[model samples]
Target chain A: MRTITKNGVRIDDTFAEAFPMRGTALILTGPNKRWARQAAVTMTGFATSVIGCGCEASIDGEVEARDTPDGRPGVRVLIFAMSSNDLQTQLVNRVGQCVLTSPGSACFSDLVAADALKVGDLLRYFGDGWQISKKFGNRHFWRVPVMDGEFLCEATTGFTKGAVGGGNLLICGADYEKTLRAAEAAVEAMNEVRDAIMPFPGGIVRSGSKVGSKYKALHASTNDAFCPSLRGMTKTALDDDIGCVLEIVIDGLTEAAVADATRAGLAAIIKLGPRNGARRVSAGNYGGKLGPFHFHLKDLLA
Target chain B: MTLVLTLKVTPPQRLDLSVLLPHLLADKSSKDVAAIDLATTREKITVGDLFRIRAGSAEEIRFEGGSERFDGVGQGLQQGRIFVAGDAGINAGRQMTGGDLVISGNVGPYAGSAMTGGRLEILGNAGDFLGAPREGELNGMSGGLLVLRGAAGRRAGDRLRRGTILIEGDAGDWLGSRLIAGTLIVLGRVGVSPGYLMRRGTIVLAKPPALASTFVDCGQFASSFPAVFGRFLLPESRGAARLFRAPLRKFAGDMAVLGKGEIFVPA
Candidate 1:
């Protein structure tokens, strides 16, 4: 496989190694956009990776008032975990703490037709025998009384299949400032794509890790291959001119969504030109053993 | 085609027409439906003696004529649609489990009594005990929807355990009396002692209702229920949803019965 370069930026012939994950989507609507985004941001905060937070969640997109229940502004969030049980636990905890506590916020399951899991059914106990269940059409909702008002939440929705977790892209640049801006551009562009979330802080992961650590207790360690400081100390994958590297981690509802997001991120960085100091875009791979989903950077760019 | 049953002669006495469910008669031929047995005040009479049956197999049955002596018209109906062009006698949809019963005119007492599921629509006035339990029964209508386009008499939704009862016009005394758990929406005025003895349920009134002194007022507040209710109601009844969009004065009552039922009026 030949490495293709676009505008002096090397596109790696390798593919991103993504593993299978159970994912569910939620729509949180509020009286206004501010509150809706507030609850969403809070729910997805600190949820960069399952290794650290037991889930990888972030705001996937925004919803118009006409499209949401209660005709209010809303935000859509996607959360991915290793299993359905893990996803359910994280969903209930995050929605209970972030959404139910937020004033005028109501959470709804995004996948209406999917087999249901008990998210709101479990959370309704917070009402303490005061919760009322109402069926609007075929969807059942629980009205849990809160301090501000009643928080209306939908009960039961399931995870969508084929969600690819840990699709990654590494941006190598001449300096730290250029690398940061390029990564920022990539994150912003990818945020526009549907069915995916970056999950990392500002959608950029600075401390990208490899599969295993030298310590027996740790399953992952820092990637020395692209670390600028470790260039002289370790066998590095970076060229001599590369002084900084930033990785964007993606978890999407489908392989297509991950590919689309990857394309969006790369296009944003490529549009910035080599003058922005971005020299290469390489993906993290584990000799094709990570999972079934392999997003080849070459095919995505082509 | 719709299986039509038209009253041929005014019966001298009332008739028990509970077995004339739409699902049951839909598949019967005209001759077969006419031979159906119906109990009258005097003795059992074939349906051919009281009505003209024009039958064909279909999920729908239409009953014409403003007859007031046909009792128990849609009992135990599980599926299909029944449309009554005029008034009907007592217990129009008793024990109905599933189906849609649309009565375009007034109905006698005990409509939708002990019903477990389905939708019963009364386009005109309703007699007493609408959606209420029978004289000796423990539970009333447990499930299904009862929408009254006109006024309702006393004891409407009495002892109702579940389901929705929407009254587009005024309701007489004892509205929602002894409701176990359900929702009653009254779009117009309501008479005295509303929500009395209700254990747990919601009574939404467009106008302030005369409540018993035992009911406690819980201050005025805005709720998301109206919006939710509006989304569930049909397009023709959208006004009921609009009426609920404003702030409501909530009162939790029936303390005399150790109940937690609530009455909501537009504030």
Candidate 2:
């Protein structure tokens, strides 16, 4: 195959594989956007992965007053868990501790569906004996009387299966600076894409981990094959001219999310390749054996 | 003219008015209010049958019927006006907080029991303990007005805290018993032991009782009747606002307990 390379970097032929996981999204509103963001950030903090954090959660985006049910500024937070039970537990605990405790903040379900069971029924007991429950339409809400006024929280959240580790791509360049620039371009392009998120910090991961570790105590270890400093010491997969590599991991709620993110990310990185010390693009995969999704980079870019 | 509900059938059994309070009927207009679905003897019945409901723009309800056995007629009514064309049943205007209820005819037992803030008026006689506390309630008629046009049954205005009750006709025994801090007026003759065991309320009786054992003779005094009744009974009266302009005599006692509440009678 005739390969496309910008500034002497190779574009790999493979694609990233992703698995399906269940996720839920919550919307938190406050007297203003600042307090809403504060509550949302606290609720989603340390919720990067299900392995360590019991769930993967983050502030998906900011919502305006018109987008909310109560006509207040809100922030949307997406939470992912291994199962329905885990999602419910983490959601209840985080909302009760973080959002409800924040001043003038009210939490409500962003995703409205009939099948979802709510969690606010249990947390409403915090009102002690004075709590009031209201049902509007099909959704139930709890009004916990507080000192300032009332803290209104939705009784339930909605959940659906979403694709995790979707549309991932790797950036390789002549040096670390070029590689980071390419990653940043990819991230910027992927921003605002619907139902998709780059879970790593800045949408790029410098320390990519392999499946298992050589040490008995560790389950996973760093991919030394891609490390520039260890090029001569380990079985290096990078060419001698290749200086740095960065990986972008994506997750989406569906197949379309993965495909759209992949397309945008590739286009952005390709556009920025020559100007930013240039780079080639590739994707991560386990030989099509790990996940159900297989995103072919050539098909995506085309 | 929100919603109106009219009874479709004259209930064979006693009708329950607990569900018909004004606060519960807020969202319904006068027309919709006349269409409330009620259950009688395990069968469904509508409100448009028994009484003719006239749609009014005012946030008040008028019932034109002479049937008795209406219970809890204005229970827990926080606001709005209710007028009964004829006599009422047990517990009429019970536990009312803020509203006006008027019964044109006599009322059954326990009218205006435990009323917190409102005004209730009965043009005819009233049963036992009118404007008194319920059997288990600690507070009684804390803030409201009750006026009876005719005689009252035994123990009228018992245990009242901070409201006013006026009786135009005769009163039964043990009137204003255990009254803490309210006003009770009897424009006609009071039966024996009018102010028995009263703590700190004003009870005015028209004629001095012959027995007069429990109540000490507080001495004769010249006082204007309309001023006395107007101060305590009529101004706040919901449907009987025109009946408070009469002369009265004031007597203070149930000296057997604390000697505070007075009994006022017509001069």
Residue A101 of model 1: what lDDT? 92
For candidate 1, give the lDDT.
0.85
Candidate 1 per-residue lDDT, tens place, B54-149, comes to: 765548878877568878878788999888888889998999999999999999999999898889999999999999989899998888888899
- Per-residue lDDT, model 2, residue B234, is 35
Error of 2 at A69 (Å): 1.1
Worst 10-residue lDDT window for candidate 2 chain B reads B220-229
Best by TM-score: 1
Q: State the lDDT of candidate 2 residue by residue for B1-267, as single tens digits.
A: 422334444667777766676678766665675576644456655566455566654357666664576777887878888877777788889889888888898889889988877788898899998888887887667777787888899999888887667777888987877887666767677777766777666676556476456555444333222322343333444222233344334455666776655554444
Model 1, span A1-302: residue lDDT tens: 35788877877788898999888889898889999999999999989999989999999999998787677899999999998888888989999999899889988888753655787799999999888776543677788888887888887766876788989999989999988988999999999999999999889889989878899999999999879898889988988888999999999988889999999998888888677758888989899975888888888873
lDDT of each: 0.85, 0.71
DockQ of each: 0.39, 0.02
How well does candidate 2 match the true structure, expressed as C-alpha RMSD?
A: 16.7
Query: Stretches of candidate 1 above 4 Å error?
Result: A6-9, B1-35, B38-57, B64-66, B234-236
